[model samples]
Target: MAMIEDAGRRRALRTLTAGALAAGGGLLSVRAFAGGLATVNMQLGWVPGGNQVGEVVAKRLGYYEKEGIDFHIQPGGPNIDGVAIVASGRFQTGEISSSPSIMLAVSEGLPIKCIAVGLQQHPYTFFSLKKAPIRSPQDMIGKRIGIQSTGMVLLRALLAKHKIPENQVKIVPIGADMMPLVAGQVDAVTGWQTNTTALKPLGADRVDLRLWDTGVRLYALPYYATTSMLKEHPETVQGFLRATARGWMYANQNRDQAIDMLVKDYPNLNRADERVAIDSLMHYAFDQTTQTQGWGAMDAAVWEEQIAMYGQLGQFRAAQPKVDDVMTLDVLKATHSSRLKV
Candidate 1:
């Protein structure tokens, strides 16, 4: 990989690597981490939970072991810079929370490419109460839209997609809390529709305006690897994809057992909550496209659409990255039969 020009980013990644080694019980390696199995430390964009049920199932069921792989999931929090970590070669691969992240990273000259999409349709939604419903982009007009500073881009994309003037909607900067929306502080709040834990406060009367429905299509839970890793070890990357596909397929087919395995892996996760949340999670994971194309499926047209939208919104600092720079079909193509098994 070319040298990463940003010094602070490199330092942050170095610190993260050291800390991950210490906190992870020891240093880990891909080819020679443990018993000669190819190791893949998957750095998550958030703390482990129901989103990782498939991986947890895979590990517990020895699916990775069957593929001669030692997969480790490293947790990421608000402080963790997962993209930097993956770009710095600290980890073999990483999974970000959303697809836009990959595009933004590539625009900044990050040497990473999305290998597969975990969720075909992004779960990001504009949540509102039933009383003052903002069911569509038109409803956003004159409404105080509560969103995090980080999510401003999403709101902008929604507006740009529908040609809604930015001044029409009031952008209310707020944390990820439903209280603001509940107390009539704002008309709506932005969050992942699958985040049932966080959505508990909104009550059943909540109205959801999904980002995808607003024409700002995006992918969530996208897996990516450094460009160097893809070129150096294509077979290893293919192996990881194959095993991961099997894990997800198993989780889709056997939901109860998957949740059972998930709770076992992470004792902190409540079984009841995960059980209820799995249905919503599965809905995003397997849709019509998944029924025909199988799991971990994605369409290039969608990626191109996101790129064009973000580019038009001036979200890309450097020159806009090509579709190939943002993602690759090789890994997905290599594991076609296994991923297609459904």
Candidate 2:
């Protein structure tokens, strides 16, 4: 979904201007409804599905309402520029599929800053059959790697980190299908490990080489807001994080019930697929770090590492972004006690 479309989406983000963002000020303020619940709309860069399970669970269970938030999700597609929309203040907050979108946007002078990350480690991985296993970055050499056009940069970063020359591997640009790999057109294909349904055809012979394990560290499903929103409405942001963290924790502990609520909220999602997907999703969401720091916790060092890696790759089109420009921990700090730990 979002991982496949980011290359073009980053280009769309660069088109946002100060004048256009200023025009959206009329809808910037957090609107309070008749019951004094503030409206908080979360704009996304991809269509809602398994990735939004926590939010769906929260909304269906009244967690947002308990936090005094009238939360709503604004769906995004290929034609929509979710980052620009949030930067322009049309939506109070936004959650993009990958962390680089936020860094790249901020470097281009967008006023948004990441407040919390939903997944501590990105689930993007290189998948190969056991017969020709690509278990590590070095194993990718001399192989045909099937990747989406937008994910070429990720492959570049992985190669760069491991000091492998780009020419060593054959890069095959393909659509979001695993058929190329299965048909021997490519040795491996790239996709999120949490996408169980898509990975079904690959079967038990599938081998995963995750992007995070390759030293190309990145966050997924990052929650962000404009600088003004973080400054003017910190409490609202904290409340949202608290409720969301609780929702994820609940989903982790009560799997079947969470998927039931999720499908009920969005009838289009198949319960069986989401139920299978959440297990993989939770593994990335909670780990040794989240056990102590709690859900949504992030380290400045990780942000700095991501910035340095992306900068070295020459991904930034404008001024290089500093760590502070990309993310802030105030909201996470405020909601620490409220978040559940594993």
Compare the candidates by lDDT and give the number of the best one.
2
True lDDT of residue 266, candidate 1 = 90
Query: Residue by residue across 93-188, what tens digits does model 2's lDDT show?
Result: 999989988998888777999999999999999999999999999899999999998899899999988999999999999999899999999999
Worst-scoring 10-residue span by lDDT in model 2: 1-10
Model 1 CA lDDT for position 83: 90
The runs of at least 3 residues in candidate 1 whose Cα sits more than 4 Å from the true structure, single-residue gaps closed, are: 1-29
The TM-score between candidate 1 and the true structure equals 0.92
Q: Per-residue lDDT of 140-202 in model 1, one digit per residue for the tens? A: 999999998778888888887888999999999999878899889999998988888889988
Candidate No. with top TM-score: 2
Pairs that clash in candidate 1: 30-39
lDDT at position 91, candidate 2 = 82
